[model samples]
Target: MQTQRSFAKQTTGTLYLVPTPIGNLDDMTFRSIKVLQQVDLIAAEDTRNTQRLLKHFQITTRQISFHEHNTQARLPQLIATLNAGQSLAQVSDAGMPSISDPGKELVIAAIKHGIPVVPLPGANAGLTALIASGLAPQPFYFYGFLPRKTQQQVAALAPLKNRTETLIFYEAPHRLLKTLASLSLAFGEDRQIVLARELTKKYESFLRGTLAEAKAWFDQHQPRGEFVLLIAGNPYPQTRADAYQHLNLHDYVAQLVTEGHPAKTAIKMVAKQRQVAKQEVYRAYHQF
Candidate 1:
């Protein structure tokens, strides 16, 4: 319930969520540079990595480490700095802070303590890949990364299996093939998906095809660089006949439970398979 007028004059120093170049240095925005230059301190995920960007722009601003390992110890200090009218900018190794990074807690603390939070948009890999992904961009959902374990990844992707909007995900090179196979299992082999890697860099390329083809391609080729995966959403329409065939929501949950699946997990899977809200599925399943 907080409103932030980014440009408004304020007594306390603002907390800036600055986005760094995902791959190309030229993608850094002019406003981001000015904010970084003006801020009292820069809380970077990796000071060593960020130093390269700072060196490129000749920004001599002091930086402090604020990564996943040190967030618990550093969040309070960052909030205190903002309260003291000393502006601080938070940046990840690349792209936006708090997007699978370590700034979400600090930002939340700043907001709770009445400190202004300003976000300067510059470069992000998700949207950068999505626009050129040849998928529907407007109604897209950005899921930062999937679970590492195979079972967990499958469970995490269950609810998203039937979404109408396009889906976005981040994955490392080593796990690319396994993730593609998992996607094929969850969404079927024929679903369309695109893999954009080495984005905005010299070797940047986009691999587009069905999930099966993607799995095959990666099987044959060695994966390299970070990837932004965009997958087409479920296109199948649910029908009343389909509902009857599945023995209704209650019976479906009961059937899943009888087969040894946890009640909560079963409800979620059923909800996803039926293309309905989880809450709706929960209520209907629980209603005796």
Candidate 2:
């Protein structure tokens, strides 16, 4: 139960989480620029990339690399700098830090050390695409970048198939087709999906259609840039009984295992669904 008064005067330095433009440079906010200029040091995901941004805005702040590869190594140093009462600003290569980038670990460390964490809101690809997706906006689940492997990806998406809120995901161009096929497999081919590419850039475009249609379109046209995928929620969520009414306990558990759940986990799930003892479901599954 910690409260952060962002602007309150404190002995320790503040950690500012700055969000950079996702694509278009013009989208960079005035406050973000000011903070970048004012902070004692900037911890960037990629110093090279951030240097370009700093040069564009004429910000001369010095930077230190703090990406996924070096997060553990850099955490102590950054935390010590903050404790020394030197303000720090953390930024990713693009968009908000820690959304699908580095900064979360440092943020946590700062919080634990009682450093104020001030976040300056700015560009985000997920919300930008969601608004124009023509889907329900308020209730949204942002699942950034699915697992690359087919089985792992399917397992990750299986539970999300029944969500009523809109689903948002980030995907690279090279793997877009594979992800689209997986989405169709898990959430049905007819599910409404919007693929927004090169967001906020000159080539930014949105393709709204059923999952199958989106897959077919991408099959013909090579996917070009980073994509923000928005999937419409399950219109008709299945009930427990309705979902597995046709299958016996053993077969139902087997199906869950086929979908990537471990056999023990699948049996537990079936037992819970059937309102029976775990031993009953386990025995039934092992019998056949």
Candidate 3:
């Protein structure tokens, strides 16, 4: 952790970046509650949202409104608060602040002035989705949210279409199907996808399939809530696709296992790389 020297000029207080729950109030951390109560000030993306959290925790700390519209204006005031040795905590409407949320600017400003920034972990929609996505978690990138425009969005995904690392994205409900359609066009029907919607809420759902399958699901059912889209990485180079073409799926998994990966996980790895059904791999394993 980088300790801001300017933080030493004052009594050495921290700017805690707190994570709030996306859905359930019970997910708030005890440490977060304690910090909120003890901090000199709390800056929230939405005062009303934070107010409810505060009310639930019985915290009465003075809160200043800071969000996208007013964040620039509040930067100086927040810096001054930290320089004066007053502890402050920053929160978005939900989840950790500044991760596709507001407060990145404030965090940067604080660092420029040498104010200590501490991140307290709690609920995060991306991590929540990735954990259950059943995709390769290692070597993955977190792309917060994609743009709404069809061409722009397609262009955005074009660069990452062939990355070997798993990719995660946050998306709005109304555009979910459109985004899926664009992905199908950009990555092709065989691209493996995992769609996590309404996470951590009563109507939570998980839809995992090929790009074509996900598009069909989206068309039949109206999406609800914020969504996290996880795409299994594409095998690099057109030549990379040649490995399993002649090997059949089982031999591919077996070869992967011979190299090192466990048989079960290797099957999944091969499935993602080939963008085929795991059942096909299983059948191949037994027949030959």
Best-performing candidate as measured by lDDT = 2
What candidate 2 gets wrong by more than 4 Å, as runs, is: 250-288
Q: Backbone clash tally for model 3? A: 0
- For model 2, what is the error of residue 122's alpha carbon versus the real structure, in angstroms, after optimal superposition? 0.2
Could you tell me the lDDT of residue 104 within candidate 3?
A: 89
The Cα error of candidate 3 at residue 103, in Å, is: 1.6
Candidate 3, residues 22-51: lDDT per residue as tens digits? Answer: 988888889999889999999999999899
| Model 2, CA-based lDDT | 0.93
Q: Which RMSD values do the candidates have, in order?
A: 4.9, 2.6, 12.2
**Which has the better TM-score: candidate 1, or candidate 2?**
2
lDDT at position 24, candidate 2: 95
Clashes of each: 0, 0, 0
Predicted structure 1, TM vs. truth: 0.86
lDDT of 2 at 240: 53
Cα lDDT, model 3, residue 250: 70
TM-score of each: 0.86, 0.90, 0.79
Q: Each model's C-alpha lDDT?
A: 0.89, 0.93, 0.85
Q: Write the per-residue lDDT of candidate 1 for residues 1-288, one digit (tens) a residue.
A: 668787698888899999999999999999999989999999999999999999999999999999999889998888888889999999999999998878899988988988888888888899999999999987989898999999989878866777888999999999988898889988899999999999999999999999999988988899999999999988894443364465888888887786579999999988888888899889988893
